[model samples]
Target: MLTDTRNSRYAKLCGTGGKDVRWTNGFWRDAVASCAKSMVPQLEHMFEAKEISHVVENFRICAGEAEGDFDGTFFGDGDFYKWMESELYSAVLLKDPERFQRLRAYISLIGKAQQPDGYLSTKQIIAAMHGESARNKDINEFEVYNMGHLFTSACLYKRMTGEDSFLDIARKAAGYLANLYDQAEKTGNVQTAVCPSHYMGLIELYRTTGDESYLELAEKSIRLRDSVVDGMDDNQDRIPLKEHKKIIGHAVRATYLYAGVADLYAEKGDPDYLRVLHDVWHNMVSTKMYITGGIGALYNGTSPYGNFFKDQKIHQAFGYEYQLPNVTAYNETCASIGLVMWAYRMFLVEPRAEYMDILERAMLNTNLAAVSLDGKRYFYENMLRRAKKLEYELIWPLTRSEYILSYCCPPNLARVIMESAEYAYAVSEDSVYTGMYGENQAHFHLANGADFVMTQTTDYPYDGNIRLQISDIKKDGPVTLMLRIPGWAERAEVTCHGRTETYGKESAGSYLPVALSSLEDAEIVLSIPMKTRNTIANPMVEEDTAQIAIERGPLVFCMEQPDVETESLDQIWLDPSAEYQLRFEQIDGRRIGVLETTAFQRKIWNGNPETDPEGASNLYRTLPKAEFEPVDARMVPYFAWDNRGVGEMRIWMPYRTR
Candidate 1:
């Protein structure tokens, strides 16, 4: 019982707890541990004020502990569940007894709060107690949404600790959901607009228990989305799942629904699902996706042609084909995390290197950037550019505060970062593939059922050099090791047992396959040249046309106000022909590379013509021959922006292409 990557048809890789593979030393291992150590303790304080109180207070409502109103938001219950899941993931690796005790306490309270018939949603239960009309009929209340998180969290907990205390509560709750939705599916009366996210959880329940009814419930939940309601545009269930050629609607909901579709396709191998999955994925990456691997282009912008709701605007949906925005871009952190989830599932089904590329892009940039360096504060909306205004911040500026009203992104980030080791490596029948690079120890079996242990040493995503050593071999036959060739690498080379090989046309954005008959004295050195290069957006994207962004290896770089003259990010333009020097610097506890470039700033001024006629005449006159001044410009990783008290930051800078 281990939490590993499982498609409906295949298991790609076991997680860190599995006997097959373990992480020894790496940037990811340190990141996972550091984030957990900093975050898990603070969560009790963070949630007690809101999320944890909701669950505890709701339990007391039934038990008559005190006369009180229902506490917290409707989705608050899921936040607590996510926090527990993150703690359990960290505890299993660290074997922390104190954390395990805390988990047991939470489970005990949750178990006590459950109704005898297996219903466990705190808000719905309270609504019933208060004699509210149609307590369970309103799907908009997120009844199943909270249940979904509960089911998945319990499944992972059982896998990590072999503990069934919480699993018992989860199973009972899952049974209730199956019965209710199964009946709803039969009558064609289900609510599709409320959200179809519960499909993923039902699949998890089926996977954990091998229950056919649970799988059937998930299938019905997905298929029933074709019954469109009036205001479900945000849910993306407007079209039948099989006919979705392009991704649309709420970005988080869109990716979560697709992840469930991928799960179903893995199990049922439905051609319709597979076709739509590929179609939507291609549509996103080719057009809708930002260069930082972020999705969802617009927030509450109205085009006067956008269809419905009181807001009269499409909220957080992918707008026109190439209408990506910068300052007002609403790349929610949960949406970015959902993209990674969907991509990982696709990778397991098809085993494509391109999927891993997108996964890496999301994990290294927008996803990691959601949390501050101290792991204490969080960002709900990630903006590509932060603009300054004298009265107030133009756009919602990034903050290092721990709490937000819609506190969904922080816990999700914590869990993903803690469990990142599981996404690093994958083992197939006759091959082992490196999904993401980091220094770590991995163990896997060959085609002959013999165990092998390997150690990877590197400072990855910072430097491209990696060394892999086969430390022990139980038995060896024919084996192939696949190394991923990142899309940004100009060149890649591998030296295996003193024989060197260079990358060619066939290797770019693909895997490099190396074959060996035995593992004795096996040491492979892989070096991918990392250099600072300018990035250009699609010419169709009006916001970024003719502007350039910098990227080094897998990291996207931005010009922050602290690193440049104040309010000069927009003034400076980079000379693409000029060479930039890389300098190592310490940011917080991490060592990051900074790029120094010689850039030029053209001076310009415009005044209110009505107020000063002389100023208006001067503006029409020649402006000192439009002199351009040389300025010193520096860039840090885009993820590192907003750490210096944040006045302004821009990723897309004006550039001199010639």
Candidate 2:
């Protein structure tokens, strides 16, 4: 999101900076508050706690400040960079001077670790110290991904703190890349991109510094992919990206690829890039994406297409379309974060409601679910469903872990969570766009040199009512404010300047452009009905054939074992007509909306026919008609699950009608 394209010809909207928006109350405010209090400090401890993560120690050893071997994952350097970036946001949000100073110190240490040539990968640096060969020049060992994080974080550091030390390291690193890629081309060392975060990084470098060479280098990097002699879908290199029709490969790599491409489209407006993005984005949303806006369906599987003889196995990848299996799903948290990034960029380039909807869905659900409510534990893979017993051991823990050996997700989610306020509002030459609804205040400085400050109050997603007050107009005339009418909301109404207009389903998924004039005591308001809706999946999705997923506004609701009366979930039926009681509950000391309703648990006949004279032990029986016994059922937001304790959890369930 720090990839600035506000003035680009193709970018329809520009982001609001820290001075422009602030989350004061409601769900997002609570999430950010939790991140500052629990998530960041805890992560700082864990990263410094060498037993859990040697991320800091690796840097220290590389810089000759400490003595040790490289002791963490190949990508831990990038993970640490992301954490540092998250702290920058936290420091600003809290206005804590000590926090800001700590971040400045960390960045200075990072500067010390950077090599003279601007090359800074801890794994490669530490390996070189022991006379080991540098690993595959940024492709195989993910040096490029680390560089990508470093560049963006450096750019953020420059923006937030006005520091040049980190930025200087990033610039040198960029210079190093420029030389390396040229050398790679001469030596044929460029194979293909793996975890291609560098693409976004290079373009952001161009945006921040206004340098032409970095932008050209980014284009060259994408071009290099077309000439790779041997490629595989495991890294989305099976074919040229422009020719890849469906998104199938490592989820993080694939989404990161698209996100970088989206950033490219925003700057250069390439038709091929836009086409490829649309194709991949459509395929992902309609077929591969989860109901909770999660991506990546397989824990481990081979890419279904390409030269079968040549393509390697795909790990943590998107499986065949509609091959959505709940219990065994592998929706990596970082992949969804990439989705949010890509969707935001796409909306900036094309400005569609669907894109923002996807962005909002992923951010609210899977991104929030990746970390626990307390923000201490984390999930490497976000499985849609969990069971009490299974034939196979969980690929990861059922509940979040305090420390994952592959610790990319926790910090990746952290930075995104800390900066989520940037995603809430956008601006153009004459109008301000409200992208996501939350309780916040906005100071809009339009490209046309007009300025206005707007304040909004809402209990959105829980309740649809929103009120806005505008003040301190600087322009001579009225400016348009484009309010997003989410694709999900129907039967909504808006009131502006004492004129009210109502809309139906036809108006869903489009922006309502409202022109505002200076007023003394007028308020703009919207009331969207946030009824608990029963969401049914397509019949092609076998796991959710007859089941329904519950949603209200933007929140997806799920049932955990502790919230239900029944011991087993196999026979539970949630009646669609059952009136849901909207109740407020304290979760992790935060008041969140919860739904309580009546559900039925089908009786299981487990008795042997001859021995017990009831039914076969198969837990099946033939009756005149299937009947279910009433059971107490309660549902909480999907993001809040697993926090109560690990047990059977479900998003989709059997359905019945009154």
Candidate 3:
């Protein structure tokens, strides 16, 4: 069994038990409130006593007519339990004690409903006693996705609240699953059945409880996933249980499977699992990923099939080809979150800065970009580009699809935001690793009862300068603090007590540490140099045609409609090394930096031949090149784009040379 009794790098960050950062702190508070508000209305409409009785009786009658029998304790639906578990876990992160208590009560109710032999699926109970013909008649398929959710709930309940009740519930469920799998293995009836979601839950249980049995079960499930891969390789008529060749098969499922594999590797320290992880990671990152760190290339079945990342197509409307047509790329928000989760696990296993780098990119851009400023509504699919009508409709590619019912992104975003505090800090035996920097305060207790405090102050993603102050060091032995310098930082300056000192730079993304003994109130300042940089996309994208995107520190910039002062931004061309002015401005009550450049004059032809040989009929760009006095062109935070009234936005603009 994998033992993580050694304190986590995030011990201090999560130990705060109080709100700190906006995304993690404020979002969690709001999720609890929003979910409570929305769920109350939903429950009122869907589950009043009378409504519950009517639905239950109707369901029972339907079952009896179809199979000539009815069974007691075969409740509402298969997936409802999973949804309930997800909500419970989300509530736990929001620190909703009442909801937590309610979930516990429901767990007890469900526990009591289980049979003597621990065979505890609602659908299975109904089907076994009634008849096999009634299995598909209702919504009672033993869903792997639902079981995964319950496992997540169990793990989260333990992590967030230090409660054991949910863990017990998870153990019972896992035992039931183990029994079924054991029987199948003995009888040679293993029919390629595995759920990726359950791996995360089982790993969490193993981490929290240090249980080997769970780890063993997790190993078996990991092996069973070979079926999914086999199915993909064989190109069977139906969707395979597992998919190889990295063909996309259910965005959420695929990510969960990858995540599960990573977690299992972390627990078992199995080199083979790591090999598989690298294979999947390389395949996905190379072919299946978006520039914004989004996944899910094909819209059909949310599967990763072909070369969908070639051009920028915005297919806002969902159909068979929703994944195709560059315009309508369905980068699911949950998939982005899944990427973060996967990257984070990789970081834990390998401790490479690249994993954390990807994690940061996803968090700052794709993941945070999914939610609106108000935190109420969210986009299920994040589109890189937008059409005028699509923008006005406030329509998102995945949200507009029929597949979503109480869609997963909102709650998924909520959980991520609520649990964001846990992602910042990682710890080894004698040292603490700082992965991402934001404004926050954290306190950590060492195993030997020594306490350390870290206070970070910065306006990050906009600025790369970070100030870290450490306090309350009581030991004579050395304690190392490793601070991550981002891959994008061309130069980094570290100072101790206002005096510059030489600290070694690790390979582009690893942490560089400063050692101090018996230190109290020691200050360290890190300055990350930022400059306007020119970057080339992959050569495979287009030959001799390079796109220009702006970079300052680790943050990437975009050209919004307001910045260009035109309805159609495609007409504008940037001069190479244009002497542009960079400055900060306040937009919609938020401060952001902007870049101003020279505009150009153009001729608008109505598909007719020009009369002049050298010069065409007059047409001027919005800001004529000669008239383009250096002006302050504002840029909101990349995460804050489209929050303003909608217009076309481009992160990569065409640059021309005279």
Best by lDDT: 2
* TM-score winner, 2 or 3: 2
TM-scores, in order shown? 0.92, 0.96, 0.75
lDDT of 2 by residue, 1-658 (tens): 4657776777888788865688889989999999988999999998898888888888888888999888878888888889988898999888899998887778778888888888889999998999988856556687888998888888888877776888888889999889978987887766765778888888888888888898888888887887676677887876887997899989999888888888777878889888898888889999999989999889888888866676478888788889999999899999999898888888888777888889999998999989888889999999889986776787688888888878999999999989988888877778778888899988877777777678889987688898988778665336777778887887789998778999999988988887866534547898888888899998899999989999988999999887876656766899988889889998877787889999988765332235634443336765534568888889999999887776889999989876
Candidate 1 vs 3: which has more lDDT: 1
lDDT for 309 (candidate 1): 44
The residue-by-residue lDDT of candidate 1 on 126-210, one tens digit each, is 7677886434676666777777888878888877777889878888987887777677777766676343456777777787778
Query: Better model by TM-score, 1 or 3?
Result: 1
Best by TM-score: 2
lDDT of each: 0.75, 0.84, 0.55
| Residue pairs with backbone overlap in model 1 | none
Q: Give the C-alpha lDDT of model 3.
A: 0.55
Question: Mind sharing the TM-score for model 3?
Answer: 0.75
Off by over 4 Å in 1: 1-7, 10-26, 50-56, 59-67, 193-195, 301-313, 390-397, 446-448, 605-625
- Winner on TM-score (1 vs 2): 2
What lDDT is obtained when candidate 2 is compared to the true structure? 0.84
